[model samples]
Target: MAAIKPKHQRLVLALIALAAILAAGALATWALRNQASYFYVPSEIVANPPDLDRAVRLGGMVEMGSIEMEADGVTIRFVVGDGTARVPVRFKGLAPSLFVEGSGVVAEGKLAKDGTFIADNLLARHDENYVPRELQDMTEHQKDAVISETVGAK
Candidate 1:
């Protein structure tokens, strides 16, 4: 084989480098395909349900009077609802501290064959101005005691 010219050698090297980068990107995307979580609301879930086997994120308000705890204590069932639709969800784990009825939540899990969302994780959504009930309902003397306990009496 004849020797490659300097100009052609640079072009070949550049092409190989470009090909390597493209291959790396494709490989990364393929590897992360299962890790990518798609978010959907209750209305969308009702309109077009996701595959039962794939992981997904369902976000909406926790329907009031729908939360129920099973005998196992950890398994809880609740309905997530947008204004128009609702999806029943079952989760077997500890819920977030702020998770409560009529509050916004995002559950990450798979859709079960029985049309229930089986959540592996739950995230509660709180407003920016949220305050704990203890703090919000505190009397003046209780607030002063807490402040003094926290900052050692200004």
Candidate 2:
């Protein structure tokens, strides 16, 4: 048997390395196939809902007059809406402090057969101009004093 020349040996090694990398990428993708979550808006969800078993994220503004608490108090129901459509979401947990009507929200979970989104997690979004309720009414000077106090204490 003739030994491969250096040039040929290097080429073979490079091809093997590339194959190994591709195999690693394929394995990673396969392993995380179910872990990936797709994002959809209310309009898209209403047009073509996702599979009931597939986890997905639904993002939209929380519609006014649509939030209600269940008898258990922990389960909250709300409607998320885009300008074109709306999706009802049911979440059985403590929502984030910023979660409220008219705010942006991303609910992560699966869609139900009944068309309601069964959320396992809720993420609330606030605008850049957001101010805490306590600070909203404070004057600029008062706000500065409070800020300095908190900073000094920290």
Candidate 3:
């Protein structure tokens, strides 16, 4: 082999290492394909059966008048619907301030053998305006009181 200069040797070694790293990353990306969770609406879930015992995310509006408060205040149960179907869910924790009836929500959980989506986490989707749906129907006096109380804390 011809005598190689130190600088050229180092450059060639670095290039080889970089190429190896890139190939490793591409292989890893391909191997990890399908690791992402699939999200489905209530309608899609109801229409087809998914592989049992897999993680998924369901997003929709909490159905109106479907919230059922258990004997223990912490364990709240409710139903979420995406206009075509409904999914009942159970959550046991302090819900977000935005969690309310008839609001958009995304729940993360696994489907149980009985077909219910057992939520491990609950995230309420609130609009820029944080007013509760119930507050909109309240009289102006009630709305003003709520606003005052909300503002007083800040």
CA displacement after TM-score superposition, residue 148 of candidate 2 (Å) = 38
Candidates 1 and 2 compared: the better one by lDDT is 2
Q: Which portions of model 1 show Cα errors greater than 4 Å?
A: 1-37, 127-154
Q: Which of the numbered candidates is closest to the native, going by highest lDDT?
A: 2
Candidate 1 lands at a TM-score of: 0.61
Instruction: For residues 21-126, write the lDDT of model 3, one tens digit per residue.
Output: 9999988886566433367667777787466687777777787789888998878889877665888888887778878776667787777778788888888875
Predictions: Cα RMSD each:
10.7, 10.2, 9.3
Worst 10 residues of 3 by lDDT: 145-154
Total clashes for model 1? 0
Ranking by lDDT: 2, 1, 3
Q: Tens digits of per-residue lDDT for model 1 on 1-154?
A: 3456877988999999999999999988976774443778877887888888878999877887999999999999999876678899999999999798866789999988888999999999753334477875676466434433432321
Candidate lDDT (C-alpha), each: 0.80, 0.81, 0.73
The TM-score between candidate 2 and the true structure equals 0.61
Pick the winner on lDDT between candidates 2 and 3: 2
Q: TM-score of every model?
A: 0.61, 0.61, 0.60
- Local error of candidate 2 at residue 101 (angstroms): 0.4
The digit string of per-residue lDDT tens for model 2 on 112-136 reads 9999999999999654344576775
What are the runs in model 2 whose C-alpha is more than 4 Å off? Answer: 1-37, 127-154
